[model samples]
Target: MMEIQGIDLSIIWSIIIAFGIMMYVILDGFDLGLGILFPFISDAQERDVMMNTVAPVWDGNETWIVFGAAAMYGAFPLAYSLIFEALYLPLIFVLAGLILRGVAFEFRFKATAEKRHIWDKAFIGGSVLATFFQGVALGTYVSGIPVVDRQFAGGAFDWLAPFPLFCGIGLLLTYALLGSTWLLIKTEGMLESRMRHYSRPLAYLLAWVIVITCGWTAYLQQDIAQRWLHGSHWMLTCAVVVLAVIALYGLQRSLRLRHSHKPFVATLGLVFLGYAGLVISIWPNIVPPSVDLWQAASPTTSQLFALIGTLFILPVILMYTLWGYHVFRGKVQVGDAYH
Candidate 1:
């Protein structure tokens, strides 16, 4: 098997999965954020416009998660099993939420006034459930789930902890920030005005949660803290930190200056910064201290086949994704819902 400067196919596959995971979090994240922000909107027309902004492309956003999961299962079956076993309950809840969200998206548009409220609530509830549990699962992953003999050894409620709960709240606020910026771009009139007002505070709140979460993660994990604080890694960590700060400032500045695209761009930058930091801190180790990427990777033959298929298919996916976004581009007015 050929190697790219000693980096094997396994590492390449891992990077592919990592990129897919990041895309899922950032893309679908905004829609989930919008759904979570629904209760704050009392005006039904405003809510409809907000939902319409994401209607044409929301399901497509979720496809990235499926790609990520499939890559994980195929490329790193051991790590995937460990994660699934440890997170089975939260994963189940997340799936239920996604299903409910899909159903709510269709029914809300056709319902009577009173029934629309019910469907709207279902949408919001699903978004909240999914985002909160995702955060919780992340916290569990960061804090380290118990494993024995290559399997999850923790109880069902083992992930129920203060840090996970805080992470849940943090995720909710982060999504809210994304949703608000998204609304500012896709809406007009009083709704857009309200979103612009809310986006700034949400940005500030997201910054706070990010700071606290990073500090807590550092304090909590000795190995990660040591690696991140030492040598060139520390410098890279500092650079990422600076970028995060700039992103936060840009988000607020764009909101103030009424730049339609800048706020969302900056928001995506912040999300990427966080994802990069997490990946750097956990590099090589797909499941932290116990299992490195190489140890968990599938055989080289499997990886070669997968990589070949990925090379052929990924560009096509990217092209259509780009085209879809372009086709759906523009602000969603009150009565302009696609379906």
Candidate 2:
């Protein structure tokens, strides 16, 4: 395997894939959260404003997931195949939800008043379904898949467990909180105030869920628990917890101060911290319990080739994404339309 400064190409690819997934989560998460928040918003104009806030950048945000998946396929074909095999059902449902949501997002604007409510329902249902199943997939992955000889050996319904279900609910709340903080940044007047009101409770619920999920995850997987609680790993765990507390405190302070951007920034910090913790817990394991990065990685030649393309393309994606957000930077009004 090729090495750069003694670091394996597989490890580098792992980092790239992880970064892509993180970008997807933080970027698309808020838009998905907007859909989840749709039910709470009764006023048609308010919903319009909420949708418009994300309309300019939402579709572009999904590019990261595609990037991540493609990177995995090119750089870690073994792990990619195994993971997809294990997660086939949930992944299919995730695609379905995304399709539904995308269709609703476009049609909702074009629909008449009578038909708009149907699209509204589609948006909400799609968002909830996608978020929930994504969580289930995460939980299932964390719990470990049964892989035998590089093939998935698990049952199709293995994901339908208590832990995964709780995770599904937890993720729903997490996205709702993200959406609320995002609204705080992109809105004003009564909508902003309502989002502010919603943000606190959502944050509180998310905090509880995070704590419980951590404990549950630890209890359910001894290897992970040892990784988190034993040896020098405990310090990293402490740092993550400290950072989480700080983020939570900052969020509350920002909300109290009525600072629009700070709340969203703090929320992003919390999400990053959680994502960092997950990576730390499962470091080097592209597929836990068996497959390490090296085991799952494609040939060094393939990884190097893909890495070159990724290096060239990733910056372009980032540049344009930033440009889009910059162009649309402002409070979205009711009449605003990105479609």
CA RMSD of all predictions: 1.6, 1.1
Error of 1 at 312 (Å): 2.2
Clashing pairs in model 1, backbone N/Cα/C closer than 3 A = none
**Per-prediction TM-score:** 0.96, 0.98
Give the Å shift of residue 18 in candidate 2: 0.7
Tell me the lDDT of model 2 at 152.
Answer: 88
Best by TM-score: 2
* Model 2, span 172-217: residue lDDT tens: 9988999999999899899999999999988888999999999998
Q: Each prediction's Cα lDDT score? A: 0.86, 0.91
What lDDT score goes with residue 313 in model 2?
Answer: 100
Across residues 1-339, which tens digit of lDDT does each residue of candidate 1 receive?
335467588878888999888888888899999989898899988888999898888998998899899889888898999888888888898899999999999999889897899999999999999999999888888887666787777888867888877888888888888888888788889998888888888888889999999889888888889978887899989999999998998888888899888998999999899989988788868887578887788887787778888888778877877888899888888788646
**The CA-based lDDT of model 1 is what?**
0.86
Model 1 clash count equals 0
